[model samples]
Target: MLDNIEADFPEYAPRRPGAPKALDGIRVVDFSHFIAGPFATMILADMGAEVIKIEAPGPGDDLRRYPPVHPDLKHGAPFVWTNRNKRSVALDLKMPEGVAVARDLIATADVVVENFSTGVMERFGLDYEACRKIRPDIIYCSVSAYGREGAFADRLGFDPIAQVESGFVSMNGYADREGVRALSPVMDISTAMMACNAILGALVARERSGLGQAIEVSLFDSAVLMTGYATMQHLFSGANPQRHGNTSPDTCPSGVFRAQDCTFYINCGNDKIFQRLMAQVIDRADLAEAEIYATGPDRIRRRDELFAILGEAFARQPWSYWQARMRVAGVPCGQVRTVGEAIRSPEARERGIVTRIPHEKLGWIPNVTLPIRYSGTPIVDPVAAPAVGQHTESVLRELLGYDDSRLGRLASAGVFGADAARRPRQDAKV
Candidate 1:
């Protein structure tokens, strides 16, 4: 078995010289895959929780296979995006020994996160009920397409389905074409945020009550919220929302516009912003003074004429010129940049939104940190995402207090994987 984990995960740096992280003492056993559950646990990891990701001996999380793949890393960009600062423990859960080792980890974990299909955990004998028996105060979280019970619990779901079912897709796209699901996994992203908040709340409650509870966050439920007030308006007005394309149904002069050289977006949320845009940015003082465009309601009533005028004016200038004018005028506007441009923008680099971090084999790779800022409990400096089963020997020996003999026994039983056979046998517990 692998005795030295440093060879497996040279990028796995667990600690740095810092003040203190909010979750310094917390330990999380992450069984989540893809986006939501992993995302939630990644937030916790950012807060300094020790996240132990249990992956199967072979392929590991499916996200590791997503593109654009790194040639040397084996895992892809999507996997690295969320799985950073986590330690990977390879275990073949199909084997009884694997299940036993998983239970051992859960017994010591403060939080357990899973996004497997309903009843899969139960079948593995690692369900919340089974886990709670090992550690009664364990905060268990299950992320799913739907709730774990009821009529639709068995149904599998992805971000697109959630958007469709929750009315999110219906609210997007132009009214003429069929409604389109957002290219981004907005539902999944929102669900991750919800699950993160729920887990944090559970942790707070546990502090006072010394008790743990289970949390369930579903993509369908969060996707509805992602639709914003459309659901509420439907209840009140008893009418379904029609897709409005890039334009907002509630606000005028709030959509994409083309400049001489580039596309840009503008949002005149209220009459005041509209006035500023006309008077300062576009220098249309007469239009700013017009009674028909003085209020938000009036502007909405005449959005077509207003858009036509604005489009003509914007077309005369390049994006940079309009952006500078809008900045001075306090108009909410930005260039409609591609993903690569957005990440490499000067502002993003200055703010450390996207920066380079050292990797084991790759030397350096781009890293995107969480957006949150804290004055006291600062986030930990991130480490690169772990390789599958990279920390198996270390975690088994250090965290689980298993010695060389035990690890060897588990390895011999085909618990770890085919790769496990290559790891040198540990002489003794670390």
Candidate 2:
């Protein structure tokens, strides 16, 4: 399925033969799964950190089984999107031998990230304190729903739950209907970005102080901040934000509108933009000069009347007609496009936002690159997400200097799970 899509789309391969990377010498031992944790580690990986992802022996990360699964890859699109530029090592953490190997790996890592429930890492003896014992200057990061400590530590939370609890869901959608949660996991994505930023900051601090610390990022806390300026507004006014749908409560002439052929949106942020919209785009100088439409507050007071006039005027022209004029007028406007349309739009193509990268089994698969640009240091080349335990043998051999004899012994002891124990010794080859 992915192969077909890549075949029709443009292929992208960044060319920078020997450029330095931002995080060239760093190594991260990633025990994170799902969106928040894995995504944070992926950002580090993109910046040239060697990220070693630890997963369970059989199923691996739960996100691997998410929808739109690839038959050959086994994992789904969500996992592929976040796990690039990383190696995967599957181990049975239930076994003492597996924990020993993890400790050995930790000793060689600069960063350790995990997002298991409050005490899961402590049970495996891989928590922040345990990791600090292995390597004193290790930067340990924990991503959780609430926090690793506190009364809500035991509570399980997801993106929708965080949105509802943090008032994010209360300030979206139309006022007439119940507020709706974002279809995208905004809370999870925002938390991941925050975790990445925190880790980067800790790395800088450690470079000067020669000390490591534990950092925590919570979904609820990030969601609350994701409410943007509304939180501050509520504090100042003591009034909660109301749902405004596509319209802006503070700005006049800022909402979805319909052109003759299709739907578009226009935002006249100030009086000048509104004047330009009237005199330049729609050619309504009478309305532009009228006292009722002179100021933002005045226009807002007669919003229904003004919008009705704009609506009738807009219905006379197609989206293309208004878009070109708006471009010249400097008015912020765009066609209300679907996900597919937006991805394939002319602007997206110009920005190279979506492209295809090579994959081992699939020949080539779709890849969405990070939106970062560096003059001296470039991000690492994209690599497809690894299959479960794909690098178990290689990681043990290279990082820990484990010999074939020791690997065989650990396998026999069920350190790599029963299925691995039953496989031929040569199958452990890197």
Candidate 3:
């Protein structure tokens, strides 16, 4: 397993020791789980917001139990990937005391994020209107399958469902077979990014007007947007996109090809790039200057023939040989790599995209940092995702000023579930 790998991997370090972070002084009460909501809040947490993740008392977030669980961490790999730089607080929202405690936290928070079904928050009295009563300037964001007030709001949806419903699946895979959904949770991830962007915009607006507003991001809506310019093209041409496998419908000679030693992808986005690929990289000026392949449309009309010729030429050399020639010719190309290969590639290492971070029990664990860079304000140094309810006592003590006696009373009332509330207070930390 990657977690067990021992090597001289670089350790994560603070970019600016004493400098302020972009979202410093911000506090977010995150009632989200799984990918979309948690990922959005994780981005906020990465930017230095104090994100308090509110999970259910017993099982907590479902992602915590996802496959490939780490023994020492007691959480799955996916949970660790998205929940870093945040505090966990387990609360039984079914109990009134738990709801009261949640309201108390909201009063002290600048933002609230949730991904529950339509009426779940309202049932717990944590909806936007209710939260606004607690903190009028709160930036409340909701992530759902559909619009919160729409007819389809009650419909349950996940990444694959959204992909199919939004026409994303229809535009992918090979033309000869049924369209295939992307294995990755592209819809969920893109929805998270949209939610984060919306929240950031809301924060900026709040700073200007001293007012906060409700923000909604839906997986279905985000999935539709993820279809890219294809939607616009469909509107303009009155036609839906057809699956073309690795090859592009708009460009010729833009797809997967095999070199002598490896497979690679090349994208000739325009005529000039195609010209460069044939004339300079492959040393085929005849093909480059041929009238049959002069323009994008012309080449696209003869895509199969061009691809066959290019394939033969690429197969004559190893990836390194073709890669070097393509680099000199200024052609855009890359080797098709697996996830493991890409993560450990020279590019990933040189950019410091992956590193090891200290873990209380595991010594160190792999960490993937965000791609953002700022000259003035840098991202926060990542902290491992907390154990279940890891900061319940400390957060209650510091934020709500609850003493041991009060905590004991709440625990006795079943506010923090069976095991969590019974745990020794000293075991929980901030």
Candidate 4:
């Protein structure tokens, strides 16, 4: 797979001046795997940073083995999706030469990202203290299950664990059954976003103070934030938030309901929306003006009766009929859609959210462009994810200016395996 790893992306050329890129000369040493840290670095790479991903020898990042693997790619879809525009350097930190080389890379790096368990970086001599000694003003970010200083820092964690422990899972699903965890790793992904924001903030501060600092983002902390303002509400009311399934606990008529054909959701978040829904969509002006349902709180108090009345009206028509009526009534509503359906919807196409990009081997593959849009200095053209140690020799030759003989000695000692001896090609562009 490493031997056949390829790229055929269009060469990026700015169409206008002053588009040097947001992180034109920034260098990031990425020592992360799986979701969080790798994703954070990928965002930086998308902004034109040079990201060097240091992976363990052998199969490298575990995300490479995830299911739904890309037929023509070395890593699976998740890995490829998050790791594009980064260089892969297979290194065995267990070996002294590998550790020495990693330290050398960190010595000149402007930023470093790691998501290993607590103390793992320290064991490899790549911790914040060691990195600071090499480059005193280097931005270093650490991602973990819990933070580094907490009592639970030693305990391992993942997205699901964070979700359950942070009250996220408790607030989901129906009150009757067990709350289900989100199938996707929401906590890990959101934590990565937080980490990226922190890294950007650090970069901005470095420009002002000429000093870099350490940043810590964890799945646990981010998961709690994902719980929204439920914690604050609970503290004030001293009441636990009940699981509402598809409905909003604080809003009336905001739940899933089946039309004659398919299921749909209605969100009458305010009294005006509820009145519009009742008068225009359901043709029941009496309900809209009734004292029992005139206000949001009153509607919530009599939700059962209101839902029964709306359900009967909605059941008389198909989802499309109710959708159109709600749209004209100024009521927020949507048809329930599967993941695949949502991706292929007309709105998604109109917005260009889902697109097919040129792939070297497959010819074209679907890519999801991020929601972020910049009027200037747009994201760099993307490249396919790299194989294990795909850029190892090139990185050494270019960044450290190591000749073939030095690379051979390192490979001879199992610093990056015998594959490191492969000739570096000019086409190995991140």
* Candidate number with greatest lDDT: 3
| Tens digit per residue, CA lDDT, model 1, 1-430 | 1123333223323344668899999999999999999988999999989999999888999999999777778889889999988998888888888999999999889999999999999999998899999999999999999899999999999999999999988888999998998998888789999999999999999999999999999999999898899889999999999988889888988999999999999999998898899999989999999998988788888989999999999999999999999999999998899986886677776666765567667666666889988778878888888888888888877888998789888887778887566566432111
Q: TM-scores for all candidates?
A: 0.93, 0.97, 0.98, 0.93
Give the Å error, residue 267, model 1.
Answer: 0.6
* Model 4 Cα lDDT, one tens digit per residue, 1-430: 2222223122233326556678889999999999989989999998889999999877899999897776567668888778888999989998889999999899879999999999999998889998999999999999988899968899889899999999999999899999889998999889999999999999999999999999999899999999999999999999988998887888898998999999988888898998888889899999889888877788788888888998888889888888888888889888899987796687776666666555667766656666776777777766768888879878988899999789878887778865554543343555
RMSD from true fold, candidate 4: 3.7
The clash number for model 3 is: 0
Enumerate clash totals for all models, in the order shown. 3, 0, 0, 0
Candidates ranked by TM-score: 3, 2, 1, 4
Q: How close is candidate 3 to the true structure, as a TM-score?
A: 0.98
Tell me the spans in candidate 1 whose CA falls farther than 4 Å from its real position: 1-16, 422-430
Query: Candidate 2, after superposition: displacement of residue 249 in Å?
Result: 0.6
* Per-residue lDDT of model 3, residues 1-430, tens digit only: 5644447468776676788889999999999999999999999999989999999887889999997998777799999989999998889999889999999999999999999989999999999999999999999999999989968999888999999999999999999999999999999999999999999999999999999999999999999999999999999999999999999999888999999999999999998998999999999999899999999899888988988998888889999999999999989999999998998889998988988987878878888888888788888888888888888888888889998899999988878779855666554443
- What stretches of model 4 exceed 4 Å from their correct place? 1-18, 421-427
* TM-score, structure 4 vs. true: 0.93
lDDT value for candidate 2? Answer: 0.91
- Candidate 4, residue 266: Cα displacement in angstroms equals 1.0
